[model samples]
Target: MLKKYKDDQEFYSLVGIKPQTFYKMLEILKIAESKQKYYGGRKNKIVIEGRLLMTL
Candidate 1:
């Protein structure tokens, strides 16, 4: 299983893609539902911005 990346930079480093590309892939993955999406932090369930990414 793929580990949950901490942030976009880490994800980019692991996946070797640019930030815009990462967002594009994320949108596709969300549509496919093959990956899980989560909002960061303990409260305020907002779609985690700046650090948005995914895991397998």
Candidate 2:
């Protein structure tokens, strides 16, 4: 769903953030996700992009 918006204006309208900001936040989230310690439980159903979009 996040990939549906490519134009900056459209992406901003949909997510209330500029594409650059969104990508930056996505990168940060990916880094944090990678650094987390595994607890050996059920995995997340949503991808990082989806989670980020949902949080917006």
Best by lDDT: 2
Give the alpha-carbon lDDT of every model: 0.56, 0.82
- lDDT at 25, model 1: 66
- Per-residue lDDT tens digits for candidate 2, residues 1-56, read 45666578988888899989988999999888867735445667998899988888
TM for every model, in the order presented, reads 0.35, 0.80
For candidate 2, the per-residue lDDT at 18 reads 91
Give lDDT: candidate 1, residue 5.
75
Question: What lDDT score is found at residue 17 in candidate 2?
Answer: 93
What is the TM-score (0 to 1) of candidate 2?
A: 0.80
Clashing pairs in 1: none
